[model samples]
Target: MNSHKQLFILSCLSLVLVLLSGQFGLQVEAGHHIHHRSKKLFVFGDSYVDTGNTNKSKPGSWKEPYGITSPGKPTGRFSDGRVLTDFIAKYLRLRTPITHRLWDYTVPKHSLKYGMNFAYGGTGVFDTSSSGPNMTAQIDIFNQLVQENVYTLSDITNSIAYVSVAGNDYNYYLATNGSLPGFPSFIASVVNQTTINLIHLQSLGFKRIVVGALQPLGCLPQATAQTSFQSCNSTFNDLVTLHNNLLNRSVTKLNQEINDHNTFTILDIFDGFRTVLNNPSSHNIKERLKPCCFGVSSEYNCGSVDENNVKKYLVCENPESTFFWDELHPTQAGWNAVYNELEKRGLYKILY
Candidate 1:
């Protein structure tokens, strides 16, 4: 027998031995199967958790300097580093889920592996000034894919959905002659509509849905910069608490109404934001009320450009030590702190 032929036979024998041993190759195969069995994450929400699903042609995400920390360039995420979704994915031991718009950009198997992100920035539960799809339309997009068999019924049955309203609807209401005096009614309307959406998602086969409560809007850098970032406007937080209380009760009621053992959950972004904002010093954060990135002048807002097209916004010396990254969102580190709190408080227990 030729030496080459003998080597080939030996290689085949070695492969058989490895398979029978169940030490390396078989273990790898079993591990892969287990990973696939884990819950797939599906995200739907506004700017706070949008991972680049916005229109790229416009100045929306996927532009310069947005993803400077993680992907080293703009990748459509609304943070300098990771966002809430990223932390959630990490907790689940899964990759950052792909955005719905970028679904075609990834491999077909990958698109189905962790589910798709339907969240778009500048959107609300109802219609908004922006032309993008509202919460109902976003769910329609998901349904269209289901009809096309892009995702199987069983795939969705085991999947987890994350929804974030993030106060866009309220902002829209305030912008269009909606006064604070009538805001409670508006809040009730929004939560009622959102409850309908959550039920629809459950009917569509989602195992568990997680929704976020409104954050401390008045404490955001955009609001508190008027006070020189020295203090949070308690009036704003008061409104937020009212909204959150209503939202929590609405979610709890939904969980009770579900016919099956399954339920929709709420992640209290309101308390999560407040916990960080109330004690920024504990997190080594200096300015809890000031955004890390700000316009060169008070008249301007974040993402402002100068005469030479240079960015006029200033990023703080230590982004990790700040809560607000820009006008509305939190920094990656800021979110990490919040996620830690959520984990400590059992908000993410069912998510993974």
Candidate 2:
């Protein structure tokens, strides 16, 4: 067998072992003790969790075909439909957090009963390809809100914070042609900064903070398209593993220092994506690596239209059957499948 197949099998086996060993510390019980004390959610990070924070005119997320699977229109979400934050809100039994742009004028204060979403698509822990606020700046916005008393102490104490860094930092790293030798150090820096961000959120009075693990970069369509969607680039995934490992350690240490096992939690996007991709049939997914919407060639993308309004890309006949919606984001069905796995693994702990 080829190396890709071997790696795939080994990853599957490792997931099984990890699950059985309870290394993730997720409760497997069917029922959970509901925590009704917290009802609001505040979100941070990038496109994966962004509801609609990207600029309306500049970002591709605001263009056609982005939200075709659910709201049936562009809503500044880098997917074909609802992204991670939507599912997380549903899991929490709270209304979706309003985007920061719409929090004041378009929506009323009482409408913020579920809190706010400050994530911006195409952003990272630091500055990235997009011009939106970095993670630090995003937190600064939250901090500003707190100072203005937009949310009172009671509101914060009754809220949960969902922070998704995804892989924008690594994307920026690759885009800048960062050296492989320096990659490990960059990953460590991201974890350290993220740890500080989590601590800041805790200090801001959030009852619980959930940080997402970096997903498998090698499995994304942007990487797989180079191989005609046949196999993932293991070298890229190695970097992802390094990031997740360091992040897990950092979170453990942060929890220890805080003296609260439940103050900070990790949303295992790495294993979650891996399990879904490795077992696509079980998740009712076909075309596992192929994206549902893409440019006909290298110069365009899913919703691209020429000056004459000529379509430049093609969309799949059935987006629901595909795992990816575009070069970098998942289809609605894909997120749902992954969310199901997350729910089964231990999302209940965060919800309840």
Top lDDT: which candidate number?
A: 2
What would you estimate as the lDDT of candidate 2? 0.87
Local accuracy of candidate 1 as per-residue lDDT tens digits, 114-224? 778888888999998766688999999999989999888887887788898988898889889998789888888998888889988988998788888888888887678
Worst 10 residues of 2 by lDDT: 21-30
lDDT of each: 0.78, 0.87
The whole-model C-alpha lDDT of candidate 1 against the native structure comes to 0.78
RMSD of each: 8.7, 11.4
Q: How far is candidate 2 from the true structure (C-alpha RMSD, Å)?
A: 11.4
Supply the TM-score for candidate 1.
Answer: 0.85
RMSD of 1: 8.7
Report residue 95 deviation for candidate 2 (angstroms): 1.3
TM of each candidate vs. truth: 0.85, 0.89
Candidate 2 lDDT score at position 331 = 91
